[model samples]
Target chain A: MLTPARLAQYVLPLMVLGSTQLMASTAVDQQIEQLRARVSAHSVEVNRFEQELLHPVDTRVAVFLTLAGRNGLEVDAVELFIDGQPVASHLYSKRERNALERGGVQQLFTGNLSNGGHEIKAVISVRTAKDQFIRRESVHRFTKSTGTHRLQLALDAHAPDYEPDVTITEWK
Target chain B: MTGLFHSWVSAPAIKIFLLIALFCDPAKATSPTVPEELSEGVVRFALATGDITAALPLQDRLKGDSADYLRGRLLLESGNVQQGLDTLVQVAQGRYHRGEAALMVARHYGAEGDADESRNWYQVAAKNGFGETRQKARFALAELQRHAGRLDAAGKTLAGMDEGYWTAVGYLNLATDFARTDLNPSRALVSLRVALAMCETDTNRERSKELKSRLLVRAGQLAYAHEDYDKAIGFLKKVSLDSYRTPQALYLHGLALSEQGNYRAAMQSWHRAKKYPLAYPGVEDAWLGMGRGYDLAGYLGQAGEAFLAASAAYEGERATLRELEKRIREAGAYKSLVDDARNADLEWFLADSRTLTQPRLAYLLGLIENPVTQRAVARVAELEEMIASLEQQERDLTVFMAALGNKPSSDTQGRSKQLSADQDALTNAVAALSGPNISPAQKRHIRELRDALNASGSVLERLSNVGGGNNQRQPRKRQAERLRKQTQSLLVEVRAVRDEAGKALDRLALEFIEQEDQRMAFALDKTEQQIAHLYEYLALKKLDGGKP
Candidate 1:
């Protein structure tokens, strides 16, 4: 019953079937590997996009304010107002007063403002040589159409009275 | 230096000779290499120094739209506002610096209190300007709307702004305006909350914290005025403990609790509020709240004692009203002095021994207490386990494949070695036959034999090696045949599991998103309900003599 031809018939077909199955399996494995790689790449891209969404580039107006100097007056406090609304008011600490007295510039306020004409009002409270307290106010009008606006406030001393001459100027 | 140069170059004879030389060199005579233009820098320096006169000459020397703009700025700075605006408008008509010029014109109008004109120009600049300029213009337009009392329009304008510190401030300002008008207290509360969330910088932290605490107290007060005791408590409890508003917040919290009939809890809140510095404004309120709590709980004698203490604390002030004094007298009549002293001592002892307890705030607090959002966490854990399992399966598969020992090159290598041995034998035989002493015929025979051996070896090697197709495929076919069934079945199972896990992960991700959406919606709904209850309570409070 187990003749050579009969055996060849059974063995050959089985061998062919086995070879085809092996090739098909190998092809399937390669496909799975390729798909996994694609999924990995896509996941990485999604994570990158999420990160971008979380932290975006900064594109906002920057206003730089500096108190230029206090001339012969012991400035006790400075208050800044924009369009009649107070934006910043600080009572000068002893260290800050000393820094201003030595011609050091103090950054008063940095914030965003709309493009148009804006008025800056500075109120300076100073102690006179006689220990009298006096407040001086100055206003500056400027246009913020483009770029940065740098504002400086300086106190000019009047000779005889030593009155605080407060001036606010916008630097280009 | 100028005088010395003049003396050397302008002597009579030298002048005559120089004139002759200039005439001979016509290019040099006509063109005195035009001095480098320093007008732009000069104009900027003059502007910075507030020197309009100095800028005027430099501006005149400048050409193009920038010159016109600079001249306009100079005129504006010099107090000639109309002239400056006219000049700037001309520059705006040009393409260069159009946004800047338009913005300047807008500012001039704004300064004059012409809001309509200012808004129009701001719109132009917002459309034409780039980066921060555009943002500023938009913000200015919104500010104008707010100033014009168009609250809704101002809110809409602010909504379009990008999330930033200024936008937060804008929201805060709008919230302040809303609260001042007393139109939509809930909107103000929401805006203040958003501002608190957006405050990220150290510089803004203190301000935002203070603002948030103040707003929280204000909102609590508003709720209390409306008689929405629960919402009042909720809002008051959120006020930061470290804030100066804490004393007032705690007093309000106790009042809300007492209104809700949680007299013991109200007493606790009041007791805690009293622990703060006694000089605080809320101290009298705290004592009064404690007395009310005791009175509501039917501890009339202890209530009388608390009221008496409060009266002593606010002797000269109306903090202890006539009605409150009458209530205290009535409570004193209900119990004997010894019993009142014993009850008071017992209350103090109990209050002192009490442990810190969970805040009875709101459903939101309940949600915060257990914030896992369970299903999402479970799904994530499952996905992590599946990934780990798959990794282990992959490692096992690698080990199995390595152990299979499917070295298909071994057969070809053996054949190659056999062919080399035969070729060496043929070479040695030829060497022996090719000696000089051998006959020509013998040499010919040896050559023929050598050629036959070499040809056979070449043919054998060619047949053995051939193209990589059959030789490579035959062994691979054998190896594949040996591995195909087992490896394929395992791979199919692995892939099927992987695909199932992937699908599950996707489902989980979608479910997570939906859950988050639902949670947010629920929170919003709860807030809206609370606000509506407040409105209803306000109506009832108005009917009940409007006592807060």
Candidate 2:
């Protein structure tokens, strides 16, 4: 058992065992590094999803038109123009007139608009008691920075000749 | 010779008499002629009797535009409206009868629903027509304006008219418009009272009475809405018993009486109302009111009977609501099933396609069949079991530590001091062997000695701790504290697993309920549509003379 050949046999196996352990440790370390990287990537995705859920994008301006009141005048048609371009035309039917009488508002235009000033014009055609057809135009200017802009077109009862009044308001 | 002389004398005498008669009454000497007024009266008599054939021959004998106007009227009354309108327009162009003709034309246009044309003709007639025609045309224009919802203009037009039957009709219309369209009950009542006061003509007396009854009912309802029960009852009592609205008025009267706590009077009024041939619109409400009254009066049997009648009347709507409630209950049951099916171990129960027909059940089955869900559930269960085992271990350790006392015995204390001295000696020897100046042979010998000393030190420390009762208590206390900490951590894990299980169950239930809610909504919508269609069919059948 004390011979050099027998001693070589024992020492050689020991050396091989030590080398095998070193290789296994290196592979294990690489695997741990890969796992850490994957965990970091998954954490980033989760944070991004949470950020998106917390805040949503709102980028459009909505414009609404409403008939405030009719002063004993039969309104036949109404046309709306935004920034000198015709956007909507509505011919009031009997049912629509009833709705307007009940204080229902109509959406005139809804689209994306940059932060700036805009002008809205409404042309209304009404029949007077004397059987005379008259066209009354009212214009309002508003600044749309965000949210919605509302315009009310009312038949002015106090006006001498049944003129239309237009007012602009912004949604807070 | 004598006869010839007598004939000559008679001829002279006859000639002298004829000359005197012609000279004395020249006005009556010509053939008798009929007066134009008498001819017009004959044509009017035929028209009034609705004998157009007789009026046709008489109309030809009439002079000037009256004949043409009468022909146009006959044509209109006979339903040749377009032809009559043409004839009236022709007459309207003439100055003699333009007023009447224009009024007729406006009325024709009004009946045809051409308000613009009617208004135009009415304006012409009002400006150029004479007497009653001008007044009637103005009233017609006002009526057209009222129907067109130009209430202010209609009021202005009516304001210019004087008191008469047409004016009364105009006021009645204005009252109805104010009440129904403008929601001005006070103004409507004023107009209606004005119309009632103006009803002096025999022809309009019955109509006015009917309108008065309607007004009384409306006023009573308005007073009821305002909670003026005495005024409501007073107004309702003024409603005529013969009016079609009598039953409804009596029902309202009963309600007003009930509001005043006059239960006997209310019941009497309701009984009277039930005897009416016409059906009351609020009959069911009357029954319900009776039930409430009986309940308040402590008449339990009567109250039950009244309530049963009310329920019968409301059977359709109650059935619909109950059906919807039943659907919700079924959905709850299905949600429970979906919750149970969320467990992967219950997959065998959900294997049938029929069980998966429900969207929520299918979704739960999908999750249960997923390997991730199975693994997650298994991991949670494992953690829970581990926590339970750790808790048991901690409990055992706590008992063991409690059995140990706080202090060590005297014999154990002496052995603990000896082990401490031996440990210090070995630590010094190991430090000396690790010095830089030590030889290899000496280092090898010291290392052997260090190994032997270390082995003995470990055994000595264990033996000393076992024998030293006070030191053994410290280690046991520390072990117990460690087990407690482990048990606490395990409890947190178990709680987390329970929370996860609860959340899973909630999510599955929510999914199942959402699907069931959509199905219920669709079913309810379909039921509502069927109810609406049934009501429409009943209305149509009523129009067709069938029972509603």
Candidate 3:
């Protein structure tokens, strides 16, 4: 109902009826450009919003699997349980194992938790350089507060002895 | 059909429709497609996570027209607009999405101010595009011609575009062109009349009535300018009382009645207008006109009293305008306005004000009617939608992430078991070759087998040998991690841009309010002048012994 001409005519009296400036030709085009930018933006925001809503910062607990050193402790699979409820389990591809070998961190799990103390159990299946298939399970205790909690589950087989060990450390 | 299966999912229609609908439909038909080499589920998961970058490499694995279209879409989505446009232009040469691609290219060039290129692509789209794409291109081409002052060309472009809603829109645009150029006022009126008739008859679109009201007001204003008071009155009288246009229509109707020497009728129109809020555009003018009508009709005492009432209304409205100006300065006011405008769609300024909850905002109905303010409001509404969509996505992504590792992929499990078996075989072979119990002949036979195995280099050998120098491909897990980080970075950038746009909108809102405040101040000045003029006439009459 509020066409540009009507508003213009209402604002100024005795004006030439056709003299009200039309909306700029580029107005819709500019709006389209803005929409494109918004599309790209919203695409990114979706993930961020999902992260917040699904795993709220206050109660979010995340576990990441990373290899600490260049020891041949090839990860075959890793399973994670929070307070004895199975949350995440993945069988690794050779390519995926190489990714971890190259210092890539894989997010094992992300879930909500109650405040205070919680137990995280990580079960890792690894193939050593000696063709030994070993299954290792480790448990760590941490506190979930009003902030995001990140736990790093590392397969450390560094220099010196190069003995492969599965360890879970809470990220401060 | 395989190509169709993939291309259909990436079709511009589905994507654009999804965007418009905000993807509220839970039962989605199309999903992201990957080549047979890559996992379809992984690509879908990547897209669901908004990690388009992670899925981008899979585009290399895709081929044919579908591949080109998908590549163009991903590139465009990832902000590679130039590449995306080029790729789409290539796709435009093919049957798949040709019309859609052509239209998009036309719009891109049009936005870039390349009128010749834009027109060429628009023509291409009109010829090649099917269904809605063709119609949209024709409309856009007509608008381009209209904007360029090519009335004849524009009319020709819109000649056969008699498809109801779009046809009405076309005529309206053409009328606007004619009115702006003043090349042919009669034709402009004709076009508006035709558009008004079309709008009246249009039943599909909910906005037809709103458009009809706009057309009436425009036609009335045009007729009034041409001194066709009867025609103006006839048109203005049809404007619905509940329409946001009613105040302006009433004011114009009063002027038209007075021009025809019907002062009593004019006074009635203005008197009816006085019932509306003074902040409504032209309502204050209506108040002033009513007093003037009384004076013209020789109701001297009533004229003086009416003038006093008009001035008081103006003064009271002035204070209210100040408060609205303050309210506009706050970002919350724009947010509230955006919420009200959620269902406004294309009619940002024409949104029903009666449904508005904010008293301060309701008063700015006249101000928000400005096209500039409307555009700003529309942008804010779009931004708010983006934010809301983002929140929904975040929740959805959490579920996706949580579900990502719940089960091992069958392919991976099968491969893992095969590798373990192969490793056992290799281990047993090596032990058999080295054992002291083995005869020399048996050892040689096993050695020959071992040599044969070593020559082929089985899956177990390759997997066990981590430092093998040949494999250079980046792993999927690493790519996913990189995409996640990039997404995090993009989130920061996008948020900053959103905030900046929001601030700009706040400034525009304040400017609209301030302009309204100035307008109210001017109206108050005019009313005060009317009051003084009325008293001067009254006193002069008393001095001449016309009244005690």
Candidate 4:
């Protein structure tokens, strides 16, 4: 009773519409998830020596971080910051002359600590094997000693790569 | 010797230098303004030609009105003292970078060793800009104060530095500046410690460690002065004075060792000190230690000789040191102290050992006191007369304590107490007088001044022996105490002489060269007289018109 041609047209149009809708929905959902995960895996540490950042008269100090324990964690980048502004950043451990470097033990960067006290924050990125990246922020604090003071940063895969952004209103 | 010295002094080479200085005008001394193009051209020329004289052609044309400061500087470098000063003065009046010119003048005065004048210019320079010129002026002011032994002023000047500029060297210099102050030894030590701490983890730099050692030595000396001998020794033990730190550190270490009653070690230190130039700053103390150690060890002759050498080393510089040696030598101690003091200070301390002051003072005062202590007193007198050259050294613990009436350092209390205990020792010595009898007035004056110094001198001597604690080989500081006493007596006489000379010289000198056409000279002389008047109005102006 029905022609073969009419049946084929009607069936083909239906199949095409359904497949396109499914693909569009899947892609949109994956993109939203990726954006959320991008900031989730990263962690941060903040430390402040003084209520206000202290600047030593003429001393050289550096910020340090450790990346040993976090297996399956891929740290794409790290940012060192002072008073909310980025001072230095490392990308994929490539050879660069941004700071004075030493092997293995820890890196010493030449920069002055503010005199009274300073709050330093480390913003790091870590991505899982599945590419699930999270951003984190941690803080360390210090006061200027008549002697040298140390700042230590530890990295762990157990932490997320991204954290909610914090805004600092005042800096000294 | 005279011929060699004369040849060096009157070298024919100096004539050429003088001629050059007189005739060489800066070729590029003229410029209307420091036009960028012109300044660049001149710099290129200077750096290229390397002929400092080629800059002279611009001199008068410069008017010191344009690139005036540079012109003034060139003029000064060319030996046109007055002209440069004039041009610089005009530039300083203009609103340009004259602050730098003022500093240039200050530096000029400093090189000439006129610290006071240098300070005046530096102060004016400081008001100019907030840049390098201002910072330089501050440094110049601090240095001048330091040179004048006004340590407080130096410290105050450096206090303006923010935490950002506490360079290691600056910190060390600041410590040194504060070390010479009325502030106690502990404070000075703290200053040095602060500097040391600031050096932090920069251990790879030689300057950091080298300066630390230098600071440690200074801290040791201060602790020694403060009677914290143990602490002094502790700090001193931390470093070796291997390089340039040798003379200064080793000397202080020896002082600390002597304080600890480690005489054998102290003597060794002193012997080591002797290998350097004799006239070096701290060598006087080394001589004292050497002689005193020998005395304690019963090598009386050697002790006396060492004392004489020490006395000579600081003859005009430290009147008390010289006098102490003379007295010990004359004390009938079976050896002569004057010869040793003279040998140490004169023969060893200086490249040129001139005996004009020590021998003259001793020769004039010999046979004036009791034979028993005459040897001692003569050494004391020589030491006292030398104070003019070592004025700063005179304001030590002994002198300070004497003025303040503080207790003697623990080590010397017994000796100082015993030395003053028996009137019989003094009376017996008086009986031994072979010279003309001294009038009661002179004796009283001498006693007043000498006794006035007793407290401080005793303290100073005691400090030389105090330690963390030890006995037996507990070397006595009595030798030092006795010498110090003798030194006090000598100072009394020297002060009297200085006062007399000062008064006489204070009179007018404009009459000496009153040539009619020399009105300029006459005016200059009159100004000098006015300056003297100004000096009298002020309590302590340190005017070269005559005042140490």
> What is the C-alpha lDDT profile of model 4 across A1-172, one tens digit per residue?
1122222222222221121111122232233223222211110000011100111212224444444342555555677776666666655331211111211112212244433467777787656656777777877666543223345454555445432232322211
- Fnat for candidate 1 (0 to 1): 0.00
Residue by residue across B71-137, what tens digits does model 4's lDDT show? 6665554445677788898887788866877877776665445666767888888877466577657
Which has the higher lDDT value, candidate number 3 or candidate number 4?
3
Q: lDDT at B273 for candidate 4?
A: 69
Candidate 3 vs 4: which has more TM-score = 3
- Give lDDT tens digits, candidate 1, residues B432-492: 7666698888878787677666645544554445434344334423443334344344445
Clashes of each: 1, 1, 3, 106
Candidate 1 CAPRI-style tier: incorrect
Report the number of the highest-DockQ candidate.
3
- Assess each prediction's global lDDT (C-alpha) against the native: 0.52, 0.54, 0.63, 0.45
Candidate 1 accuracy as TM-score: 0.31
Model 4 DockQ class = incorrect
Q: Candidate 4: deviation at residue B87, Å?
A: 4.5
Better structure of 2 and 3 per DockQ: 3
TM-score of each: 0.31, 0.36, 0.55, 0.31
Candidate that would win on TM-score: 3
| Model 4 chain A worst lDDT window (10 residues) | A43-52
Tell me the spans in candidate 3 whose CA falls farther than 4 Å from its real position. A1-172, B1-80, B130-132, B180-184, B198-203, B275-280, B339-353, B356-491
